[model samples]
Target: MRDAYHEELDALTDRLVEMTRLVRSAISRATTALLDSDLQLAESVISHDEEVDRIFAEIEASIFDLMARQQPVAVDLRTIVVALRMGTDLERMGDLAEHVAKVARLRHPDSAIPPEIRSTILEMGQIAERLITKTGSCIASRDVESALELEADDDAMDRLHRRLFKILMADDWKYGVEPAIDVTLIGRYYERYADHAVRVAQDVVYLVTGSRTQDADLR
Candidate 1:
C-alpha cells in the first residue's frame, strides 16, 4: 500500500509539472502573437485556455483523492497542499495569457503599443516566462534555493514594470487616454503574472524548507 501511495504521489507531481509547462507555453505564445501581430496565434492561445482550465480541475481532483486515500502527514501533506496552490497559480497565469491574447486580437492589424514601448513589453513578457519556468523547476526538484532565486528574479521584473510606467506617464499628455489605459492594463497583467509565479515559488519554498517566506504584495 505504501508503494502504491508513493507511486500515486509521484504521478501527481508529474501532472503538476506538465500543467506548468502548458501555462509557460501559453504565456510565451501569447507574447509572440503580440509581438508579431499574429491574430491566428493569438486566437490559438485563447482557445488553449480551456485546456489549462481542464488540467487545473484534474489536478484538484487528484489532490483531493490523495488526501482522502493516503491521508498524507507532515512533509507529504505539505507537498500535496503546495501542489494544489501551485495548480491554482498556474491556472491564473493561463488566464492572464489569454487576456493578453485578447488584447492582441483587439489590436489586430495595428499593434496596441507604440514601437518604442513594444520592446519593453516584450522584455516583461520574457521575464514572466522565465519566472514561470523557474517555478516549475523548483517544484519538480523541490529545491528551496531555486525557489528563493525565482523570488529574486521577481524584483527585476518589478523594476522593469515600474520603469515602463515612468515612460508611459512621462509623455502621457501627448497620447490619448485610450492608449494610456491600454498600456496601464498591460503592465498590470504582466506584473500580476509575475506575482503569481512568485507565489508559486514561495509555496515551493514552504514545501521544501517548511517555512513560509514573506507573502508577495500583488498590488
Candidate 2:
C-alpha cells in the first residue's frame, strides 16, 4: 500500500510536468501567432485551451483523491498541496497565452504589435518562454537554486513591461489610443505569464525544502 501511494504521488508529479510542458508550448505559439498575424495558428491556440482546462480538472481531482486516501505526511503532503497550486498556475499561464492568441485572431492579418516596438514585444515573449520552461525543470527536479533563479528571470519581464509603458507614455507616440491599449494589454499578458511561472517555481522550492519560497534561498 505504501508503494502504491508513492506511485500515485509520482504520477501526480508527472502530470504537473506534462501540464507545464504544454503551457510552454502554448505561450510560444501564441507569441508567434501574435507577431506573425497568423490567424489559423491563433485560432488553434484558442481552441486548444480546452485541453489545458481539462488537464487542470484532472489534476485537481487527483489531488483530492490522494489526500483522502493516502493522508500524505511531511514532504509528501507539501508536494500534493503545492502541486494543486502549481497546476492552477500552469492553467492560468495557458489562459494568458490564449488571451494573446485571441488578440491576434481579433486583429487577423494585421499584426497586433506595431513595427516601432515589435522587437520589445518579441523579447518579452522570449523571456516568457524561458521563464516557463525553467519553471518546469524546477518543479520536476525540486531544484531550489533554479527556482530562486526565476525571480531574476521575472525581473527581465518586468523591465520589458516598463519599457512598454515608457513607449506608450512618450510624447511622439502616433499609434493612437486603440493601439496603445493593445500594446498595454499584450505587455500585461506576458508579464503576468512570467509572474505565474515564477510562482510555480517558488512553490517547487517550498515543496522540496519545507520552507516558504522566500526563506528557501537563505540556505
Candidate 3:
C-alpha cells in the first residue's frame, strides 16, 4: 500500500510538470501573437484554454483522492496541498494568457497601442514570460533559493508595469482615451500573470520550507 501511494504521488507531480509546460507555452504563444499581430496564433491560444482548465480539474481530483485514501501527513500532506495551490495559480496564468489573446483579437490587424507604447507592452510581456518559466523550474526542482529569486524577477515586472502606466498617463498622451484604455488593460493582464507566477513560487517555498512569504505590495 505504501509503495502504491508513492507511485500515485509521483504521478501527480508528473502531471503538474506537464501542466506547467502547457501554461508556459500558452504564455509564449500568446505574447508572440500579441507582438506580431497574428490573429491565428492568438485564436489558437484562446481555444487551448479549455485544456488548462481540464488539467486543473484533474490535479484537484487527484489530490483529493490521495488525501482520502492515503491520509498523507507531514511532508506528504504539504506536497498535496502545495500541488493544489500551484494548480490554481497555473490555471490563472493560463487565463491571463487567453485574456491577452482576446485583446489581440479585439484589435485584429491593428495594434491598440502606438509604436512607442507597443514597445513598452512587449517588454512587459517578455518579463512576465521569463518569470513564468523560472517559477515553473523552481517548482519542479524544488529549489527554495531559485524560488526566492523569482520574487525579485516579479519586482522587475511591477516596475515595468508602473513605468507603462506613467507613460500612458503623461500629459503628452496622443493615443486618445480608447487606445489608452486598451493598453492599460493589457499591461494589467501581464502584471497579474506575473503576480500569480510569484504566488506559485511562494507556494513552492511553503512546501519546502513550511512558511508563507509576504503579500505582494501593489503600490
Candidate 4:
C-alpha cells in the first residue's frame, strides 16, 4: 500500500510536468498567431486551454485523495503542497496564453502589435517560453539550483515589458488609442505569464529543499 501511495505522488509530479508542456505550447502558438495574425492558430490556442484545465483538476483531486488516505509528513507533505501551488500557477499561465490568443482573434487580420513594438513583444514571448521550459525541467528533476534560474529569465521579460510601454508612450506613436490599448493588454499578459512561470519554478525549489526564499520575494 505504501508503494502505491508513492506511485501516486510520482504521478502528481508527472501531471505537473505535462501541464508545463501544454502551457509552453500554448504560449508559443499564441505568440506566432499574434505575429502572423493567424486566426486559426489563435482559435486553436484558445480552445485547447480546456485540456490544461482538465489536467490541473486531476492534480488537485489526486492531492486531496492522498491527503485523505494517508498522513503526509516531511517531504511528502512538501510534495503535496508544492504540487498544489505549482498546479495553480501553471493553470494561470494557460489562461494568460489564452488571453493573448483572444487578443489575436479580436484583431483578426490586423496585428495588434505595431511595427515599432513588434520586436519587443516577440522577445517577451521568447523569454516566456524559455522560463516555462526551465520550469518543466525543474519540476521533473527536482533540481533546486536549476529552478532558481527562472528568476533571471523572468527579469528579462520584465525588462521587455517596460520597453514596450516606452515605445507606446513615445511622441511619434501614431497608432491611435485602440491599438495602444491592445498592446498594453498584450504586454501585460506576457508579463503575468512569465511571473507565473517563475512561481512554478519557485515551487520546485520548495518541493526539493522545503525553502521558500525565492517564492517570498515573488509575492
- Tens-place lDDT per residue, model 4, 67-181, is 9889898889888987999999999999999999999999999988788888898899899999999999998998888887787888888889999889889999999999999
Top candidate when judged by TM-score against the true structure: 4
Model 4 alpha-carbon drift over 4 Å, by segment = 214-219
lDDT, candidates in the order shown:
0.84, 0.88, 0.83, 0.90
Reference-based lDDT, residue 127, model 3: 82
RMSD of 2: 2.1
Off by over 4 Å in 1: 213-219
Give residue 57's error in model 1 in angstroms. Answer: 0.4
TM-score of each: 0.92, 0.95, 0.93, 0.96
Best by lDDT: 4
Question: Looking at candidate 2, what is the lDDT of residue 46?
Answer: 92
| Candidate 3 lDDT, 10-118, residue by residue in tens | 7877777777778788878888888788999999999999999998999999899899989999899989888898899889989999998888888989876677777
Instruction: Give every collision pair in model 4.
Output: none
- Candidate 1: count of backbone clashes, pairs at least 3 residues apart or interchain: 0
* Cand. 3 TM to true fold: 0.93
Error of 1 at 47 (Å): 0.5
Ranking by lDDT: 4, 2, 1, 3
Order of candidate numbers by TM-score, starting with the best: 4, 2, 3, 1
